[model samples]
Target chain A: MLKKTALHDAHAALGAKLVDFAGWEMPVQYRSALDEHHAVRTACGMFDVSHMQAVDFSGARTADFLRHLLANDVAKLSAPGGARYTCLLNPEGGVIDDLIVTRRDGDAFRSVVNAGTADKDIAWFQTHAAAYGVTVKQRTDLGILAVQGPQARTLVVPHLPAALRERAFALKPFTAAWEGEWYVSRTGYTGEDGFELVLPHADIVALWNALLADGAMPCGLGARDSLRLEAGMNLYGNDMDETVSPLECGLGWTVAWVPEDRAFIGRAALEKQRASPPRRMVAVMLDGRGVLRAHMPVRDAAQRDVGQLSSGGFAPTLKQSIGFARVDAQASAPFEVEIRGRWLPLKQVKAPFVRNGKALV
Target chain B: MSNVPADLKYVKSHEWVRKLADGTLVIGVTDHAQDALGDVVFVETPAAGRKLAAEESCAVVESVKAASDIYAPVAGTVLEANAALADKPELLNDAPYGEGWLWKMRADDIAAVDRLLDAAGYEAVLAAG
Candidate 1:
């Protein structure tokens, strides 16, 4: 049976099309994906992301444990409420998952991971924590809601606790603060100024209703995927997997190579890869009349097969198709994508084709 | 929902065919199909004057999420193709029965139309699943 989230009824009430996604029956779209995508880019939109698992680590050695487990340095989260984006990798430096880790206190931190990989991530942590005496707890009682867009802050501020409102408004990017029972973080996947709120699951329905009454549009996974793609964010399994390394997945910037004395799980293998990186992830904009889709073959100027599109879709904001392709590092700026046996011309551009309702390409 | 004129015929796969004043028949996907496809992004139609057999794959419609093949409802020779869809494919989602018609064909055997489902039978097929 497919698992359902706390907001499943709410999605159905709004006439959303629900589909099975990674073991959860979730809303794929409400009304139209293009409209929802435009709404989040132009104004505000909310997503019920309760399916994502939240794991908490608490112990004197929590920081130490994470330092050795993550490819990025978790010690940099020295200040309370600071958050860092990092990747957990295998011994060979292949990506296990990319997640956000926030320091709630000196000995406690919260990490939210993808729903499909939650069990494996928790098991990995448990297996590694035994040596460090750290405790890993999955908080299934909490519900997460991401309210994102240019006007997201304004829509959510009035509903927050008065004391927490000011701090949440002032919170820096990638930081979270505890307000009573709510954990509000100024972080999002839409490349917009927004807050991810973690609160009691029982209170989610009331909160969702309040947000809808305040004119915040309810969006679903379809808009979420398109919005994140436009923001150039990577989906866990699609953009990279166990066989792919972070360096080749447009995530080398997130790796921390400092503190040469401290070796993490994947450092040596990564260092060896750094000497000779094999492939590079590039963003391609389809210039012709075709939609870029996953597994579509990419061709070089000579029409030789170089790589394949890992993720692709039509950007409602840009009115064009865009995608990420893993191609040989030697493949230069111009390329083409094979769609329906015809090579559609494309231009390799910097990521984030659109953000904040504006085309950045 | 709009009515699927009784005079026209449909396939369980959702293609619709209407006999024009001339002996040719017009072909397109149904509104139900376009709604399921969300926003139509690109379309690939067969060239004009090509001959197609009944149930033969004749065109392709691509949305943001998936691609679908449009099968020929009956054996016919392609008479004309919708040139407007080449630049504006969303017409398939906006007007699947009118401006979004994919192609027109001259039926090789007019009796082939009798084998197609009528409006009521097509609706029953849609209601089943």
Candidate 2:
């Protein structure tokens, strides 16, 4: 059975088309994906991302444990209320998940992970944290809502507590703050200025309704996927998997290579792969009459099957089909995607096909 | 939801066919199909005068979310296709049963239309699913 969020009834009442996504019955779209996608790019949108797992790590060894657990050094989260974008990797240097770790205090931190990989992430943390005497607490009592877009901050600021609003307003990118019972972080998956609010599950329904009343459009997974894709964000299962390495999945920037002395779980394997990364991730925009879609074959100039599209869709802002593909690193620009036995011309380009209501492609 | 005209026939795969006075068949995706697909972005239709077999993929309808194949309801020769869909594909979502007609075919066997579900039969299929 698919689990429903607190906004289930609200979504149904608004005529949302609900689908079972990663075990959660969530809204895919209310009116149209294009409208919702445009709303997030131009104004403000809210998403009920409560299905994602949030874990609380406390005690003296919290920092030390994360240092050994993540590919990116957690020591960089030195200041309280700071946050770092990092990747949890398998022993073979393949990314298990990419997440944000927030420093709530000296010895307390919170990490939010992907919804589909929550169970596996918790298991990996529990198994590895045992040796370091660290406690991993899965905070299921909390609900997360991401309010994103250009006017996001302005829409949410009025509802925040006065003391919290000032501190949150001063938050830099990737930073977080704890005000009363709410944890507000200036971070989001969509490429927009927004906040991810973590509060008690009981408080979420009211807060979500208020956000809607405050001119924040309630978007669904359809818009969420398009916005993240146009922003060059990677989907866990689509872009990378257990067999794919971080270096090959457009996530090399998330790996911290400095302080050569501190060895994390996947350092050795990554060092070996870094010298000769196998496959490389590239972004492509369809130049002709075809929509790029996942599993479509990518061909080089010689019509050689070089790779396949991993994540793709019509970029609302660009008004074109764009996608990410794992291809031969030596492959050059201007490839072709085989859609229904026809080769459609495509141009390899730097990602972020659209951002902040503008087209970058 | 717009009305599904009683005179038209529908296929289980969501294609709608209207029989013309000249015995040709006009084909398009149903309203529910367009709604489920969200916003149409690009559409690929078969060339005029092409022969097709029943259930053959004759066109492609792509939305912002995914792409779906529009199948032929009966063996026939393509008479004409909507050229406007290439520039304004969202017409399929806006007026699926009217201006959104994808193609017209010279029906090879007129009896094939009887094999298709009527409005009520198609409605029952949707309900059963």
TM-score of each: 0.94, 0.95
**What value does the lDDT take at residue A296 in candidate 1?**
93
**CAPRI class assigned to model 1:** medium
- Please give, as one word, the docking class of candidate 2: medium
Evaluate residue A122 in candidate 2 and report its C-alpha lDDT on the 0 to 100 scale: 96
Scored by lDDT, model 1 comes in at: 0.88
lDDT of 1 by residue, A41-146 (tens): 8899999999998899999999999999898898898899999999999999888888999998769989999988898999999999989999999999898999
Tens-digit lDDT string for candidate 2 (B22-51):
898999999889987888999999999999
Once fitted onto the true fold, the runs of candidate 2 whose alpha carbons sit more than 4 angstroms away are: B1-3, B21-24, B109-115
What is the Å distance of residue A297 in model 1 from its true position?
1.9
- Encode model 2's per-residue lDDT on A1-361: one tens digit a residue: 9988777888899899899989999999988888888889999999999989789998788888898889888888779988888889888988888899988877988999988999999999999888878889998888899999999988887777788888888889999987777889999988989999988877788888888888889899999999999999999899998788889999999888988977898899999989778889999898766777888999899888889998988887888888999998887767888887888888888988777777887
Q: Which residue pairs of candidate 2 clash?
A: none
Question: On residues B23-125, what C-alpha lDDT tens digit does candidate 1 reach at each position?
Answer: 7899999988888888787898989989999999989998877888999999989988999998888789888898999999988998899889999999998
Model 1 misplaced regions, further than 4 Å? B1-7, B47-50, B83-88
Candidate RMSDs in Å, in order, are 2.0, 1.9
